[model samples]
Target: MELGLVGRTNAGKTALFNLITGSTAEVAPYPFTTREALRGRAEVPDPRIDAIADIQDIPRRVRAQVQVVDIPGLAAGAGQGEGLGGKALGELRQMDALIHVVRSFANNEVAHPEDAINPLGDAEAIDIELLLADREQIERRLEKVRKSAKSGDATAKGEQGLLELLVTEIDQGNPLRIVGDAEALALGIGMGLLTAKPVLYVINSDDPGEPLPELVAYATSRDAHVSQLAVGTELELAQLSPEDAAELAQEMELGDVRGADAMVRAAYELLDLVTFFTGSGPPEARAWPIQRGLSADKAAGKIHSDMERGFIRAEVVAWDALVAAGSFSKARESAQVRMEGKDYIVQEGDVMQIRFAV
Candidate 1:
């Protein structure tokens, strides 16, 4: 899963990225500092994988990695090629989900691009910008489709009609994500509409301890997820040793300093993704991310195409069940391990063994 961090200038986007990825990306209190997208892998937290690995005596390794891209901050005229706007918007197009970091903190030293700290207003502004970008994209594509429609091509006419409806819906302030069924909506997939992607709002607070109700309400209204974190504090936490960080967190009354975990989990959920594990061998149990509701065969493909092609049956065990049974043999004896067919839905935290002909 790839998640992009985006927001207006000085909205703590890079700070959040650094916090999550432990990356040393140059985060300054200004716009356009991160000119290129910074890529890093984040390990997903799963205790079952740890327990299984421990029982199997596997060496620890990072499991369930998600790629995080910290793109340059976007501005008002970004869609029109202003102030790295084109590059930023282009980066956003590649992301599976967006983490829109809104500035909820008030700091006179670090000036907000809009000269205010209203997260709701900032989120709305960003939405409008995305909508405008999508509108322009639709219009441009519609021009070509219109010519094809004039040719009396049946497929072209059908596609043109869909585009017209999409335009109408978008003009009515509806995002393309909320439009219709994925099959019907696949007609406009090539258009690269900005509003088509799922988004999660992150309220960047100056005080690491405080929560913003306004931002929470805004996210709820849109049915979008919200995360709150003091980017600067997280950055500091990232610089410390794990033990030191825990001690500091205790001092600050921060429950668990796994802000990165929350951020990554939210990103995964926003993208409708789930994780499955492979191997009971040492060197850490491996975890792979797949789209939710994927079939056993498809989940095997995520590991290796060879596995998919040679797939016979999958020996699956739920994480908790396996942990409770204490061993794979025990789990199998207790009927916790079940043989799943190719079409079986892959559940999150499932430990799977592919029985292949080859």
Candidate 2:
């Protein structure tokens, strides 16, 4: 899965990216600090993997990961190819979702294009740019589709109708996300419309507290998720030793869950993903992120094509069950493991061992 961090310049997107990816990409107090898209992997931290490894005495454990891209900040007229806006929007097209970093704090050293701390307004600005980009794209495609439809191509006719509806929606200030028609939404997503993608709004607050009600309402109206983080504090925490960071975080009443971890978890949920495990291993114990409701055989394909091609059953047990039983053998003896067929739907935290022939 891929996610892109997008917002106006100096919204602390680079700082948040550093906190989440542990990469020291240069962060300056100016717009467009990130001139090019910076890519990194964020390991989805699951304690269940650790527990499985501990109980099974596995030598290595690998957590599932998400690919994150930090695109340069966008400005007004970005849709018309303003500074770095063209490149930024191009990168956003490749993302499965967007993590919008709206500036909610006042920083004298940093400069905001609007020169104000209105998170809601900042979010709206980004949304409008995305809408403009999509509108241009759709209009261009619609012109060709209109010509094709005139030739009596049924598929082209259908697409032409949908595109016209989408144009109407966009012109009326309605994002494609709120099109209210399944076919239209799916078509928009298929066309890679920016407003059609899932969004997670991250409020970069100086004193992180309850997110502003205006921003929350905006997200709710658009069927999106919203979260807040003190990016400055989290970046500082990231610089400290783990032990010292924990102490200071405790002192700051930030609670046990780190901002990066929470953001990653929310990203997974936004993508409708579930994590499964392969627990019986001397070489490795690993967590696998898969789309929810994926069948057993397809999930095995994630590990290796040979496993899925062999076509066999999977011995599945819950992570906690395997840990409580002390070992896979013990778990089998206790009837904690089930022989699941290839059609079985994989569940979250399921520790699966495929029994297949070569």
Candidate 3:
């Protein structure tokens, strides 16, 4: 999965990206610091994966990873060639979900675009640009579908109606996310509408323990989610060595933690993903991120198409059960491993070994 970081200039979007990605992509007080999209892989830190590896005494353990892209900050008139312009907006369409960084912390040096710290207003500024950009996209696509609709194609007609509704919704200063059954909207996913993506609002604050009412209300109103973090502090911590960082955190009364884990975990949950293990005792053990409720045959395809094509059964056991049973041979002896077919739904924390012709 690829997640995009977006917000207006100087909203700490880059700071959050740097913190989570351990990337020194350059964070600045001004806007548009990131002109080109920077890609990074963040390992989803799951102790369950670690525990399984420890129990199996594997030589290597690989955590599931997600790709993150940090794009340039947007501003008013971005849809019409403003800050970052079309290039930035196009990247937004490619992301699986959006991590909207809002400026909630007060710092005199870094200037807010509106000259004040109003998170709701900041969100509105970003949302308006997204809406206008989507409008331009829908209108252009609407013309092609309209021609098909003129030919009395029912599918085309339904698409035409939905596009018109979307245009009206944008014109009224409302986001497409508020539209019910948004996923079913005709040409919605194909159109890559920015407002339709899931949003996670991260408030750049001094005291993350205390919630910001305005920001929280804005998220609730949009049916999205919110999180808090001191991005600046986190970014600084990320630059230190693990030992030094832990020492400093201890001195500051901070617990054993890292900001990257928190951010990645939230994004994983937001995307509704589950992790399953592959390999028992070997040179390597790995965690694979799969969508929840994926059937055994389809989930195997995620690893390799050959595995799915071979048409074979799988030996599956819970992570804890496998660890308790000590090894695959031991698990079989204890009847802890189940023989699963193609229709079996893979559960989170399941460790599987497939028997296939391929």
Candidate structures ordered by lDDT, highest first = 2, 3, 1
Best by TM-score: 2
Greater-TM-score candidate between 1 and 2: 2
Q: lDDT of candidate 3? A: 0.82
lDDT digits (tens) for residues 147-206 of candidate 2: 999999999999998998999999988878889888988999998899999999999997
**lDDT by residue for model 1 (1-358), tens:** 6888888878888888877777787877766688888998766676667887877677875567778899887788776666787777888887877889888889888878767778888888887777777777777888998898898878878877888888897789877777775744565445556677778888887666435777777676556788877777777877889999889888888778556677677777776777888765665588788988999999998888988999999999997788788778889999999999999999988999888876
- Model 2: ten consecutive residues of lowest lDDT: 263-272
lDDT of each: 0.79, 0.89, 0.82
In model 2, which runs have C-alpha deviations exceeding 4 angstroms?
A: 54-59, 281-283, 320-327
Model 1, residue pairs in steric clash: 58-282, 59-283
lDDT of 3 at 273: 84
Better of 1 and 2 by lDDT: 2
TM-score of each: 0.90, 0.93, 0.89
How far does residue 221 in candidate 2 sit from its true spot (Å)?
Answer: 0.7
Better by lDDT, candidate 3 or 1: 3
- Over the stretch 88-176, how does candidate 3's per-residue lDDT look in tens digits? 99898998888888888899888888889888888888888888888888988889999999999999998888888888877887677
